[model samples]
Target chain A: MNVYIIGIGLIGGSMSLDIQVTYPEAIIHGIDVSDAHLEEALQRQLIHQKATLQNVENADIVIVTIPVHASIKIIDEVLHTVKDDALVIDAGSTKEQICKSIAAHPKRRNFLAAHPIAGTEFSGPSAAIQRLFEGKTNIICEVEKTAFSLQEKALELFKNLGMRIRYMDPKSHDKHIAYVSHLSHISSFMLGKTVIEKEKNERDIFDLAGSGFASTVRLAKSSPAMWTPIFEQNKTNVIETLDEYISNLQEFKNLMLQDNFEGIYKEMENTNYIKKILKGLE
Target chain B: MNVYIIGIGLIGGSMSLDIQVTYPEAIIHGIDVSDAHLEEALQRQLIHQKATLQNVENADIVIVTIPVHASIKIIDEVLHTVKDDALVIDAGSTKEQICKSIAAHPKRRNFLAAHPIAGTEFSGPSAAIQRLFEGKTNIICEVEKTAFSLQEKALELFKNLGMRIRYMDPKSHDKHIAYVSHLSHISSFMLGKTVIEKEKNERDIFDLAGSGFASTVRLAKSSPAMWTPIFEQNKTNVIETLDEYISNLQEFKNLMLQDNFEGIYKEMENTNYIKKILKGLE
Candidate 1:
């Protein structure tokens, strides 16, 4: 079996590492826009060979792991070129756009839209590590659109990577991810911008940042190249979530202005349900 | 030596654990409004004895660790009653109000306003742990207001806990903390509230939340009992920081509405400097 992975950065590189371990007989081909990423991926042995669009014709499996916008642009082209029986999967954060782009493709049955809900704040091939998807959730959207055999093959691969699979439609997947993933990156990025703009002295941020600040702002370090496209592809949902978030903050601020300590306390106490939800993730 | 810890919760209880290990001969007295907390502290062997306001008279060192509003209300009383040489320190998130409350007290020189930048999201006595202060920053505001000898004694204790000490004025401490510490809490809390409100299915949140979302919203689980007062006490700074954060979000939302992907990308790129700053923390 030959596997072709596009956008050989954090997600792609990590998937390549795990696939190599699980399917030792499989030949891995890497394709990325950056010469440096392809070089790094090859040096790290993430792929057996560096290939391009032409390689998809021979691939038994093709994985698109680029920014969401980029994935939307290139997935159709890959779908038009892959072997008839090949399983084509994408691991982009947003699903609706990419799934919609290939909806009418003749090879739609061969494509699977998945988001392996895993990543650190770091990006690029160097940030890749083994077992990145282990014990994590993998959300597969529009599963009905994919052929049953291909779905089973993808499930086997995900199971081998130690992932639990969940299924949802493309629209629901976009809405849920907007709140759970994209909004978090936006919050952290804005937080970093707000703090950096206000606190002129970097020494003060260094000395004063506690573990809470570190954890809260950790995603601010995420790659703009990756996230901007996600936000762009899922603009409606992202904006909706952002509006809700901004309104919540404004409400809290109004309570603060009014010296409504009890109100503020009640708001936070109500949200403490997140504690129980997060424990399940752990 | 006798050490009196008021409000025996997370910070106070954890401090007791370390102080006992460092000063075995010192008698530890715990005071708190919550009887259950005192009982748990004693059961955990976090304190040598549970005491009352009367214990302040015998205290050679008094540490005020409670809600910021409560700390403000009680520090003057603690200052008036402690031994002339007893070192009094308050580990509240905000510093200006607490420091000012006791500024004119006769025993003011014995009091040190410090904010140890450490803690997990969990709270109460059970949340306390050994070495909670280990290798973390301890910001001692208005150090000049503390007598030289008492400062030396306080330094020794923080050093024994493996904390690096830095100095600042109380006002500056509150302002900086509002951004780095307090603002992070608000962001997390609001993020949690927004997600909870939107994603009605608790199971969806449990299944979909990745480590990035988990870390970003971890502080949302922090005790409202503790944070409400901190926000109230540092109202001006908190409000200021929230305005900036809200403004940043609004600006990003505007860019998203305009499909200004480049603008949003640039914003996140600029704030990527946070990655370098966070490296120093690790």
Candidate 2:
């Protein structure tokens, strides 16, 4: 079996690692814009060979894992280039527009839009690791659009890699992900921005930062090239989440101003239920 | 040596655990308002015996680990009752008010204000664990205000717990901690509140919440009983930090509205420097 992995970064590079282990007969071809990353993936054994988009015609499966801003055109190009019998998948963080863009294509039945919710603060080939998707949830949008033969191949890969599948519509996926995933990134980035701004005048301000600050600001280290497109694609839902978040923070500040510790206590206690929800998810 | 641990919750109980192992000959007396906590501390072997405020006179060290709202009066009461040579320390999150409250007292020389930057979301006696302070920074405010002999006893305990000391003025400690510590809690709590509020309308919203969301919202699980007083005591600084955080979010929203992806990318890229600051902290 031959697999073409476009954009050999964290997600794609990691997929190559697991694919190699899961299917020993598979020859993985790495395609990336960066020569350094492609060579790095080759040296790290994340892929068997370095290939361009032209080599995708020989692939049994083509996995596109580029930034969301470039995903639609690239995925369209890949679908237009690959064999009709082959399965094509794009693992962009946002699915709504990409799914809509390919909805009327002749090879629509050969495509799958799956987003695996697994990553780290780092990026690129060096950030990839084996078993990154093990026990992670892969949200597959419009699975019914994919041909039965193509769907079976993707399912087999997910099964071998120990990933569970959750079917979601493109619209609902973007909306819900905006609240959970996208909003957190904005909050964290803004937090890091605020603290860094304050630390400028108060040189020793960071010395007082504890594990809490580290945890909340951890996502601020995410790749701008990756997250910028995500926020841009899901702009509406992200703005809605940001509005609610900003208002909630304003309410908290007002409570402090009013000397209403009781109200402040209730606000936090209500949100404490998140602990149980997180525990249940775990 | 006699150690009086007032308020047998996360902070006090954990200190009891370390003190027991560090000073095997010393007896740990748990002094808490909750009878259940006293009994639980006894059952968990976190304390050697249960005692009250009146017994503080026989103490070599008095640790006031209650809420910051109640700390001033309790520390004053403990200081009033304890022997002149005994070191009376209050580990309040905010230090300025607590230090000023006892500045003119006859036993002011016996009082020490320290804030240990170590805790978990869990509270009460059952949440206590040994070596919690190991390698953690203990911000000591007004270290020079305490009598030399009394400060020596507290220093010995810090050394035995494997904690380091950073001597900061009370005002600076409170101001800096407001940004690093208190502001993060508000951000996390507001994020949790925002998502939970959205989940009410969009059920299964949290199903898409990844490790990023969880990491960003983890501090929401912090006890409101512990945090409300912190926000109340450090009201000005907390509000200033909140205003800055909210404005950053607003600015990001405006950037999104204008479709300025470049501006959004720059915002996040600038804050990416937090990674290095946090790394240096570690």
Candidate 3:
């Protein structure tokens, strides 16, 4: 099988490596707008070759792994260009916009909207690894809209990469992802900005940062180009989640100001339910 | 040398283990308000034996690793009881409160206020590990208030644990830590609350939590008992830093709402300075 992956950054680059490692017989071609990324991907051997969309016409699978805005554009472009039976899947963070973008395409049935819930703060081809998707969940939205053969092909590919699959509506997927994923990036980025602004000496931050701060601010290092569109595409849900996050912080602040130790402890105790949830994730 | 640790929870318990391994001849005694914690400490071999505050009076080194408020109370109870030459240190997150509480003690010069800027989300005696302080910064506040000989003893102890020591004024330590440590905890806890509230099904959170979300929200799993007083003692500083964090989040939210892609991208791009800072840390 031949796989063509668009946007050779972290997610796309990783998928390229994972696929190549899992199935050495599969030819992997990568596409990216950044010449630097393509060069790095080649240096890292993340892809067999650099290929354009037109060159991907013979591919058995075409994965759209671009940023949200570019993902929609590529999905539309592929619908007009790829073979009718080729399995086209998108590995975007949010699903609604991408699904809506290609809703009217004639070859929409060949397209599957999937979000592999896995990544690190690092970006570019150098960050890609062979097992980035192992033990992670891959949520596929509007699966019934995809042709049965294409859906099966996508499922087999994800399963081969050691990922669990789930089905959900595009709208619900967008809402849930905004809370779990997008909000985390926003919070981390803003926290990094806040500390950097107040602690003017960057050296002090480096010397003083313990694992606690490093872990909490880890996602602040994510790619801006990839995330900006995700925040924009899922605006309402992201804003609602951000508002609740701010309100929760404010409530804790008020409790601290009043020296309400019992109140603060109870609030944290309540949120400690996250422990059980996190364990469940493992 | 004999070491007496007043509270055998995460910080204290971990210190006991590290000290035992670092100084094999030292006999460590543990005391805590939580009898259950003391029991666990003994069963885990975190301490050689359980003892009371009276055990501290004759010890070569006495360490108070309790909450800020509780540390103050313990200091008052044992200030006169301890040997004049015994090097006493408190490992509380907030230094100002604990330092002030012991300012007028007749044995004030024996008390050293130190905050080892290291910890995990997990807590209790079971969390103790042998090398928690290795390669970590141990900040000592108001060291001038400590007698020169006692200061040397305390510094030697931390040095033996492979910790690099730095000195700062208690007030400045509290303020700096508010940005580096306290604010990160609030950001993480509130993030956990927001996601849990937004996604009613904990299963969805467990299934969909990517590494980005998991890393960013990891600190939310910290012990409420340990953190509640840290926030309480550093209330003003925490409130100030939290307000800055909220405003930063609001700015990002506005950028998304207005579809200011360039602005959002620039903000996140600028915050990516964290990568350079983190690189320097390693």
Candidate 4:
């Protein structure tokens, strides 16, 4: 089997590593815009060979793991170049734009839109690690749009990587992800910005940051190059989530100002249900 | 040596475990209002004995690890009861109020105002773990007010527990903590509240929550019994931090509305300095 992965950064690079283990007999090819990333992927043995769009013609499977905007621009081209029977998947965080771009394509049945719900705050090829997808959720949007045989092959691959699959329409996927994933990145990034701006003394922040601050601000360390596009692509949903978040903060502040400790405590107690919801992710 | 820990929950319980390891010969006595917690602490063997307020009279060292409001109400009584030579310390998140309340007490010289900058989201005796303070920072406020010998003993104890001590004025400690620690908790709790409110389908949230969402919302799981009094005690500083945080979010929303992708990218890129800051924590 021949597998070609384009934009080989954290997700693409990590997928390459896991796929190599799952399909040892398969030949892997990588395409990335950054020469440095390609070099790191090679040194890391994430790919057996480096290839471009023209070289993916014979590929049995092509996976696009670039930034969402880039994925939207290049996914249709990838579909056009791959073999008719080949399977193509795009693992972008925001799926609506990418899925819409190829909805009317002649090779639409050969493409699948997936968002593998996994990652660290770090980025780049060096950030890739084995077992990243193990026991993680992979959301497949517009699954009915993909050819049945190709969907089966994709399912086999996801299962081999130890991922559980869930299906949703592209629009629902974007809305849900905007709340669960994209908004989290924004909140964390803004938190980091607020702290850095208010507490000019970096040493004080370093000295006082406990595990809570570490966990809450961890996402602020994510790649701007990747997340900026995600926020832009899902702007409406992201903004809606952000507005709700800000209103919640405002209400909390009002309760604090009014000395309504009971109200504040109740708010947090209500949200404690997140503890149970997040247990599976741990 | 006799050490009495009042309110043996996460912080106090964890401290008892570490202190036992550091000073095996010392007798550790615990006092908590919750019988269930006291029972759990005893079952976990976190204390050598259970004690009342009268029992603390003979204590050579008394550590108050209760909620900040309770700490303010009871610290004076604990000070009045302990031996003249006893080194009394309170490990509350907000230091200004606690320090101010005891500033004029005759036994003030025997007390040390300290805030150990460490904790997990979980709480109670069950959450207690050995080495929780290892390689973490412990801030000592109003150090000059503490008796020289008592300060030395406290420093020795913190050192034995593998904590690095940094000194700050009580006001400065509370202000800094409000931003670095308290604000993070608020952001996380509010984020959790917003997402929970928006995503009615708990299953969707459970299935789609990625590592970033989990990290960003981890602090929401913290015990409300512990945090409510903290917000009450640090109201002014916390409200100020919340205002700044909300304004930052509003600005980011405006930028998103305008499709100012470059502005959003730069915000996250600048906060990426947190990567360097948090590395020290790990």
Candidate 5:
């Protein structure tokens, strides 16, 4: 089996790690915009050989894991180069834009739009780890748009990577992700910004911050290059979620201003139900 | 040694677990408003016995772990009953109010205002675990107000429990904690409310959520009984922090509305400094 992985970063490099272990006969070729990333991936054995977009013709499987903005720019050309039997997949965070952008491509049937919901706050080849996708959900959007045999091939690879597959329409996938995933990143990043801005005045404020603050703000450490385009592509949905979130925070502030302790207590009690709901999820 | 723990929930129960192990000869007497909790503490060996506020008269060390609102009401009474050599410390999240409440009490020297910056989202005696305080920061407010010898005694126990001590005035402690601790809880709780409210309309929204959402929302699972009083006690500082937090979110949303991807990306890049700051912290 011949596999070509574009971007050689966390998601691609991690997928390369798992794929090589699962398919010993599969030759992994890495393609990246950065010479440094490609070189590092080779040194780390995340890929077997360095390759490029032109070399994709030889691929039986091609996984594109670049920024969503970059993905839209090249996914058409990637589809143009891959052979008829090849199964191409993208693990971008937002799918609706990419799926829509490639709708008219001649080789569209070979491409799969999947988002494997897995990551650390770190990025790049060095940040990649084996089993990154283990027991995680892989949301495949517009699966019917991909050819049946190619979908089967990608699903087989996903299973080998220890992932659970859930299929959804692109619109629904982007909308749902705006609430669960994108909103949290914005919330976390803004929280980090708010606190750090405060730190300029309050020396050693972080010294007193415990594990709770750390956990809640951890996602602020995510890659801006990656998330910026996600927010751009899913702008409408993200804006909607942000409006709701900001309003919620505003309402909560008003409750405090009004000295409504009972209402505040009730809000927290209601949200505590998240504990039971998230029990088996982690 | 007689060690009285007056509130056997997560914080109190956890301190009891560590204290008993540290002071091997110390008999831990658990006090709670609930009999079931006391009975559970006995069965779990979290405490040697159950006692009430009146029993504090026999105490050499008294630790109050109740809600901050409750702490202010009962603290002076507990200090009145403890012996001159006793160190009565209240581990409440908001220190200024409690500290000021007991300021002129005759037994003022016996009181220590402390906030141990440690805990899991879980609560109750069943949630108690050993080593909870290991390598965690214990913020002591108004330390000089406590009797010097008795302060030394409590400091020794904190060291034995593996905590790092940082001294701050009660006002600064409450102000800083309002930003680091309380603000994060409100953010997490509001985020949880936003998503859960969305889930009511969007079926299976959470299945698409990943570890990021879970981590960011984890604190929302914390007890309402524990946090409501905290928000109430730290109202002014929390309001200030919330104003800045909401304003930050509004600014980000405005950037989104204006299509200022550069500004958005720059904001995230700047806040990425949190990655380095929080490295050794976790």
Candidate 6:
């Protein structure tokens, strides 16, 4: 099988690397606008060769893994050009926009909207590594729109990547991701900004930053290029989640100001449910 | 030297384990309000024996590693019971309250107020392990209250544990830590709360949670018993820092609502400075 991956950054590049490692016979092709990244990906052997948008026409599978807005545009362009038998999948965070963009495509049956719940703060070809998708969840939205054979092909690919697949509607996918993923990026970015603004002396932040700060601030290192579009595309849900997050923080602040140790203790105890939930995932 | 640890939880147990590995001749005595933790500490061999408050009086050095409020009470209690020349040190998050609690004690010269910037989300004596303090910063506040000779002894201990030491006023220590450390815990706990509230299905949280959420919410797994008092002790500073964090999120939300893509992009782009800061620390 020939796989064409657009935007060979962390997610896309890692997927390509994983596919190549697991199925050595599968030919991998990559497409990226950045000349330097494409060069890096080629030099690192992340792909068999560099391909253009038109090259996706020959692919058995075309994966759209660009920034959210760009992913929508590329998916439309690929649908307009690819073979009817080709399976086109998007690994974008927000699904509603892309699902709507291709809702009326003549080759709509060839497309599948997927979000493999995996990523890192790093980006670009150098950030690519195998096994990034291992033991992770892959949420596929609007699966009924795709042909049965294509859906089977996509499922096999995800299974080969060691991912568990689940189904949901595009709108629900956006809402759940807004809560679980997008809001996390915003919280991390703003926390990073607040601390950076507070300690003008970078040395002080470095000296005092423990693992907590590093973990909480990790997502802030993600690509602004990728996340800004996600925040914009899912603006309404993102804003609502952000408001809920801010209100939670404010309420806790009020409890602290009143020196309500009991209130603070109870609040944290309630939130400590995350431990059980996290362990349950494994 | 004989070292008596007041609380044998994540901090104290980990310290005792590391100290034993690094300094074989040093004997570690354990004390805790919880009998379970003491029993676990002894079972883990994190300490030579479980002892009582009386054990603190005979020690050459006593390290009070307990909650913020408990540290104050223990400091005052130790100040009255320890030898005139014994070094009494604390490893609490907030220094101002603990420092002031022992300000006028006759043994103030022997008390060292320290905050080591290291910990994991897990707590209890079972959570302790070797090398928790390696390559971490240990901040000593209000060193003026400690005798020069006693300060030398405390600094020697931290150095032997492979920690770089920083000296600052207690007020400044609280203010700086409010942003660097305390705010992180609040952000993480609140993020955990927001997600858990949104996704009523705990299984969805575990399934959809990626390394980003895991890293951002890692501190949410911290013990409420350990953190509740910290929020109460640093109530004023924590509330102020939390207000700043909330406003930062609010501003980002406003930008998103306004569809101010450039503003949102630049905000995250600028916050990416944390990467450089973190790299410098490494």
Q: DockQ for all models, in order?
A: 0.85, 0.81, 0.77, 0.86, 0.89, 0.76
For every candidate, how close is chain A to the native chain A in TM-score? 0.97, 0.98, 0.96, 0.98, 0.98, 0.97
For this target, which candidate reaches the highest lDDT against the unseen true structure? Answer: 5
Best candidate (score: DockQ):
5
Quote the positional error of residue A66 for candidate 3 in Å. 1.0
A-chain TM-score, model 5: 0.98
Considering only N, C-alpha and C atoms within 3 Å, which residue pairs clash in candidate 2? none
Chain A TM-score of prediction number 2: 0.98
Instruction: Tell me model 3's lDDT, rounded to 2 decimals.
Output: 0.86
Mark the regions of model 6 whose C-alpha exceeds 4 Å error after superposition. Answer: A280-282, B201-205, B280-282
4 against 5, candidate with superior lDDT: 5
Question: What lDDT would each prediction earn against the true structure?
Answer: 0.90, 0.90, 0.86, 0.90, 0.91, 0.87
Clashing residue pairs in candidate 3 (N, C-alpha, C atoms within 3 angstroms): none
What level of docking quality does candidate 4 show?
A: high
lDDT of 3 at B261: 83
Q: Mind giving the per-residue lDDT tens digits that candidate 5 earns over B163-248? A: 99999998888888988899999999999999999887665667788899999999999989989899998899999999999999
Per-model TM-score on C-alpha atoms? 0.97, 0.98, 0.97, 0.98, 0.99, 0.97
Clashing pairs in 6: none
Ranking by DockQ: 5, 4, 1, 2, 3, 6
Q: Record all residue pairs in model 1 with backbone atoms less than 3 Å apart, i.e. clashing.
A: none
Q: Which ten residues in a row have the lowest lDDT in candidate 5 chain A?
A: A198-207
TM-score for candidate 1, residues paired by index: 0.97
Per-residue lDDT of candidate 6, residues A1-282 (tens digit): 889989888888999988987788989898999989989999998888889998888999998889999887788889989988999988999999999988998999999999999878999999998898988899999899999999999998899899998888988888878887888899999999998887876466468788788888989999999999998889888888988898899888888777778999998999998888777443
**lDDT (tens digit, per residue) of candidate 2 on A1-282:** 999999999999999998998899999999999999999999999889999988898999999999998989888888888898899988888999999999998889989999998888889999999898888789999999999999999999988878888999999999899988999999999999998998887766687888888989999999999999999999999999999999999998898889998999999999998987787444
User: Candidate 1 at residue B91, lDDT?
Assistant: 93
